[model samples]
Target: MASNGSDPHGPDRPVVGLTTYGERAAYGVWDHDTVLLPSTYPDIVFAAGGIPVLLPPRPQAAAAVDRIDALVLSGGPDIDPQRYGADRHPLTGAARAERDAAEIAMLQRALEREIPVLGVCRGLQMLNVALGGTLVQHLPDAVGHNGHNPTPGKFATTMVDLVPGGRVATAVGTTVAVQCHHHQALDRLADGLVVTARAGDGTVEAVELDERPFVVGVQWHPEQDATDIRLMAALLAATRT
Candidate 1:
């Protein structure tokens, strides 16, 4: 096992890399572009027994995978429609081109290396799009309601049922209530990936590539729930194998 220098859990504790958002912000008299993420992400990773490394969107960010044992594609803005051969939707947020490129590259490298990966919200959509899948663009248009994202800046609670005997089920059980805040979802699932969970409204909520050690994507934000570390814990556990 690779030693995580200075990690309190000793050298065997896995190192987990998380993707962050690149956007304009103001901090301490500085108002400019910055790379940042909600503390919840790192907090959950730490609670899961992994050292968190925040990866900014950059040309060489994917290379960081070589130093980490697992990867977490954190939630962010909508992906560029062109990446999946579609026109932009009016409701779809503008694409973060650099973030899209960086995360896709990292995901590719992680999958090739067969490292554990967890995708949240936009991360889930990215997993699908990166692997030849398509998104619904505007989820409300397809689901007939904005229940998935009923408010801005706040996560809504929703119920999802996992497929029996699936990896997701094993980690979080067959039925679970999750925090959701997404306006897009998987439309055409990619090859080698299977739908492992869905919302009561029939919207896809989770997916996984069973062939890999651990490649799970959840439309909800598990990080937001300080109590449930099962998903992240599962990713950390996969790093051991």
Candidate 2:
């Protein structure tokens, strides 16, 4: 029988380590540099019957894989283009070098250990770049519009078509409406990643490394929609094995 995760005597839940943002933040009268992440990320994880652990960017963040059952590369700032051998685009936002280095190390370590991983938004981009993939840098320039990020500080609605029999399809079916807020997307796909989903505008919406038990990256913010948790739930399920 599966434990409900609420009872102390029940089987222990999987520990999910989520990467966070290293930025200057304000809370009350204190305005200083801090490690932060949206509560929605952890909220959805806990709802899916997993223990959530925040992983801040640090020199040795990759060591965290030794203590976690799964990893989530949460959404945040743009990755430095130089990491992938590209010149910065005029429209590209400033990169968080430290965060990029730390997350990449953590991701590589997680992959080496075959730890289940789920990437969201910028997290998706990181997965691609870390695996020798490249990003469009500016979707508006490539797609000729900003529909993927129609508004600032708000999510745009996007309908994605999932490839049949893929991990994403098994979790969320063939078609799904997702919340999107990204200005960049996957360009030259990595060597082993399979395209699992795409937007109506022909944007790459998701990718996965089929060789691994679970390594999925979605260009949408699944955590934003509190009502739906299929993605996070699927990630937690992988941790059990």
Q: Highest lDDT: give the candidate number.
A: 1
Note the residue pairs that clash in candidate 2.
none
Candidate 1 clashes between residue pairs 3 or more apart in a chain or in different chains: none
For candidate 1, the per-residue lDDT at 204 reads 93
Clashes counted in candidate 1 amount to: 0
Error of 2 at 94 (Å): 0.9
Weakest ten-residue segment in model 2 by summed lDDT = 1-10
Question: What digit string (tens of lDDT, one per residue) describes model 1 on residues 37-77?
Answer: 99999998888778999999985999999889998999989
lDDT of 2 by residue, 1-241 (tens): 2233544224687889999999898999999999999999889988787788999898497897888989999998789999899999998889899999999999999998888999999999999999999999999988899999999999999999999998889999999989999999999998899999999889999999968989999999999976788888888778766
Q: How does model 2 score by TM-score?
A: 0.95
Choose the strongest candidate by TM-score.
Answer: 1
Stretches of candidate 1 off by over 4 Å are 1-8
Could you tally the backbone clashes for each prediction? 0, 0
Q: How high is the CA lDDT of each candidate model?
A: 0.90, 0.89
